[model samples]
Target: MSAPLLIFADTILTGFDPDGTPILLEQAALLIRDGRIADAGTADTMRRRHPEVEAMGGRGKAVIPGLINAHHHVGVTPFQMGAQDHPLELWFAERLRMRDVPPDLDTLYSAFEMVASGVTTVQHLHSRAPGDVTAVLDRANRIIGAYDRLGMRVSYSFAMRDQNRVLYDDDQVFLELLPAAMRPVAARYLAGFGLSLDEQAQVFYELRNQHSGKERIAIQIAPANLHWLSNAGLEMAARLHDATGAPMHMHLLETPYQREYAARRGQGSAVEQIQRFGLLGPDLTIGHGVWLSRDDLALCKENGVCICHNCSSNLRLKSGTADLNAFLATGLPIALGIDEAGINDDRDMLQEMRMALTLHRPSGHHSPAPTAAQVLQMATRHGAATTPFRERIGGLAKGQAADLVVLDWDRVTYPWQDSRNGFADVLVRRAKAEAVAQVMVAGRTVYADGTFVNVDRKAELDRLKKWQSRPRTALDEEMAELADAAIDVVHDYYKNWR
Candidate 1:
């Protein structure tokens, strides 16, 4: 933390505190010493605080906290866009099958887009191929190195599942499991979900056993499904939680069918079962609680359980939108997520925020939708609070990790204070990826005025594109291929889902 890295902005959007407050230090200067914010005030005060400070100049710029993307599947391929819209279960299965089998570049491009759009922190709910955790780890190392260069804060967990096989071992039963009519429809449903139990454990064990930095490698747990996991699997999940004190993540209550599975198994609710098995608390971050009832939301609030709200994914997959109003009414912490590949196209959180604003329109209920400020709160403050790193990141405050974004207001021209335009509303409606001016991570400029600091992006993309284009060999194609076909068939069958 260098003392007095002097920075000035037209307006510095400070959400650095526990509450996401907008502190507009107009014409003010901030001095970051070493990396901590040493002092901030009018130019006069800052100068007095740091007489020998170096100046980083900027004018007419909007500075805000670097975004924290609470949920993402890093190995998102271009082919992953094959399944446009589908339900929850099928969507996950498709994702599971299509993982890191795709080229590493496809994933890199998606991540680059996220950072480019001003996302400075991301929690990757990643999936990788089995018997090849190292391959996935190697891939992850590449990605993390890139993130380091871009100065992004990232926490990664393997998308995990050891349950389905544990419960039902027969191939025919699995094939006949999904409705025959829905098979073709569901094919397009799944793609790049995450890794299996074996894969997840291997990755976790390796990361925990090997990682050396608090900032670099963070161990994470993802229990893919309660029904498929054996008692042993649950114990393993708990073991991970107990052993490393790392974070645990999963998808909970995103579909009606998941609830049906719980009912059939006499397990009440997946979240409840998970909680009973010691999987709830400040460390557990559940993604897409779109279908959770008020009671379920309350359980989360009571336990300090944070949820990653994937607004675009829920809408696109017809999983139903999270009742954000009810959730807020519960005082439950919530973070924004762009389900892998993104809601409409690409890994753009700005677009995700916009979709969240308008998706819950009643047939004509007519209420004022939430504002950009509201959604931004979820993405930055609430999102930061979801992970174990909450104390370190998520807002623009002195002494907080120096993670932030600078907006290009000159090009954006958004503050058209007309009859219907507020600056906040304009930011939500009109802000584009092009308007993201610069990004800083850990007090260093990772992305400045549209250039990344890490790896050679052009060369990296070229290699990944070439690698993805090459087909998987017959010997290497067994499980994931079968999974992909199943997902494709299921998605196609349910193309016109009710």
Candidate 2:
């Protein structure tokens, strides 16, 4: 806990109301103590009442609740690792070409990007690595350790996928499509991720127990996706959720091919199948629900399930735009995510907010689109609800965690601005990462001006670049060749698919 402090801004968007609009207070100050908001009111009144409290963020700053990146993977994206933006299915093959970066370095690399953009918390979904329980646990710990060092809150999960390692079919079935010589190499690669359903469950429990006491870290469950898990694996996810009250984040119906794959299962829609296993509820969040139907959305609403919208990822990967308008009509709890990366292959929440703000408006003069307040709610409040840290890290209400971003007000409204334009609209459209003056989490400044308070970012980045420049090892050479040969087969299999 730090000493009591007050943050005064020219304007403050405190939080959202019951009707999902923003609650703005002008010339306001928030009193923070022991890492939580103690009070909020007009700057003059707050200063009069607590004249002795140390102050920050005067005149030129606009304060808002800290933004959350609800769904994310990898510190360095696959594109940065040499994989282009292929469609989701084909991209899985191209993903093989990515060279490995150590867990800590990979995590810190992205942490720097996220914090600079005023992101205070992240839901990190780690992809399945080729390892046993010990190796997997160590990798998770290293990632968590990175966040702790950076003072960022994180909800972390190791995705559990027991099948469909390469394509939508069984591993052996997909391997048969390759030449006999390549078959052995492919089989060897597939065998690398051989953790059974039980081992995967064990991994979740061990991680939850290990991080049980952490204030800034929460270990959660991820069932990979509808195509990635078997019926038994789905049941395991439900069992884990029931055993502990942890929230579950699952990827489902992200693309048309995924929708078709669900249909072929003969088990009904992906939502129905998951419901049959008793996984539908407020605690389960569906990632990238691009192809969900009206009925699917209805079921999700009835069950209190949340949907995380990855607007930029959908566009970049050629996954069609999600029906966010339909989602809003149903009143489902909707959040925003930067899965893999955003539209520009970076993690800028302000740019993502602008993308979503303009993307949903259709041709009709009165067509429904997101208001700036709603998008801000998605990035802050709703995003927090999808994680275990709900109620603790989202808003500026009294007793809530004092996590917020201070933006340079002058930069946001440069040269000229109209008084008639709402602050939400102006800020969402114009604010950039460069406009972030300071970011605070738990009442402590983690980033200010252009530097992280804790890490020497340039030195760390230089070290990573030097390490990656080393000559490829024998295994690296083998994997590169294998990826080249496998991509053609993978492409053909999906070309005529659905």
Candidate 3:
């Protein structure tokens, strides 16, 4: 019946705008009704007209769009806590072992850390480990629904692949083809590589029916990798995209080794292959496209396919830093991600941005570093675009949701003397998570003044620490328990390539 009043002082990082030009609106005021921004302008103007509204004194805080996490395997296995510094294959093995832990409260706690880090939205490629699929979906829904009530946007993707089932049939074939000593290693490795085409598609279609378009949840496709997926799987993904109208968050060229293997096997590059499958389109987003050629980037631009740049995760796993300049220069849509709950051993976008900036130091040429403003935008506006929620929550503007994060200028973005100094610069580099003065989701202060109103932090974290993680064979220790283990596995898998 009446307009809800909201006001801010000094500055507001208007994340996006109706005019298509997002800008910083100073001393701005906003009026929200039914959870969406009704209008915005100078504080004095709006407060005068909407006289009966409540006031939230800005007290010199900078209001910006709530952060978005574009790529994450949120229910990371606890043993995944300390990832072995390895390439993609070993990383996947560690993830497989991580999945050995039972999914329960521990899974949701991973999502909690994302939220507490000022990540208001997350896109998770749900683990497809051999677990109760129905139970996994059930817990996945519960996790997302919690965020829905908490006023955060979530996009959950089922990690679908035909190779979830052991790709081979008999040990006799492997025994005849390989040395007797290596048969056990080869068998177990291939066995861990699982889902048959029929079963994978069945699981995917079932998940599509259960989650997509239901109560703010959307389905996405995570075609696990090149070796495992079949043509049937890709076709089903396209059909699912049409039926549910959700995005496809596929993993592509995460490592050079995968690309070389595909070439050696005559499977073609993963990018080139997916394109031929008719799966590349606007709803398609590829993660860790590190080996992308200029042609690949152009194809992505031509098809309007976006890339989720997982900077920190890429570096941590030695996958190489994302080609930031190349991606930006292509003029294609790009989004940012931490890629894991405690990715790069941190929980906040601020840290991720910093890493994304410095890791790819240009050779022979240097200039002004990428600005904090641009990095923040990728994490917010661009990251939000990873899902349909972009139009709803990525920006601070009239008719946008009032979801925003207010920073404590004094403590974190220190020496905030004049706006002329570009306050945003300080915030991008120096601000601490504790300095997040207030966080609003859909016009409600879910987290304010260093405390969360929607979920109990202590309780959620306690639940995680208390998850009674499965016995002794932790990936952290055994992932590379002996130097020879990795050397042996690599020799078995890659010797043919050489």
lDDT of 3 by residue, 373-425 (tens): 66776788777777766677788777777777777766664555455656556
Alpha-carbon RMSD, candidate 1: 4.8
Report the C-alpha lDDT of model 1 over 48-120, residue by residue, as the tens digit.
7777878775676777777888888754543453443556556555553443444346556766888888887
How do all the candidates rank in terms of TM-score, highest first? Answer: 2, 3, 1
Q: Which lDDT tens digits does candidate 2 get at residues 1-498?
A: 689999999998878889987888889999999888999999999999999999988898899999999999987888888888988887888887788899888889888989999899999999857778898889889998999899999999999888888889999877898777778778888888899989988888898888888778998999899889999999999998999989999999999999999999878998998999999999999999999998899899899999999999999899999988888787777999998889888888889989999999888888888888788888999999999999897788899998999999998888788979888888888889989999999888999999999989998898888878899887777777777777887888888767
lDDT of each: 0.67, 0.89, 0.66
Best by lDDT: 2
Measured over all alpha carbons after superposition, the RMSD of each candidate to the real structure, in angstroms, is 4.8, 1.1, 4.1
Pairs that collide in candidate 3 are 162-195, 163-194, 163-195, 164-194, 164-195, 165-194, 165-195
lDDT for model 2 comes to 0.89
Estimate the TM-score for candidate 3: 0.85
Better of 2 and 3 by TM-score: 2
Runs in model 2 with CA error above 4 Å? none
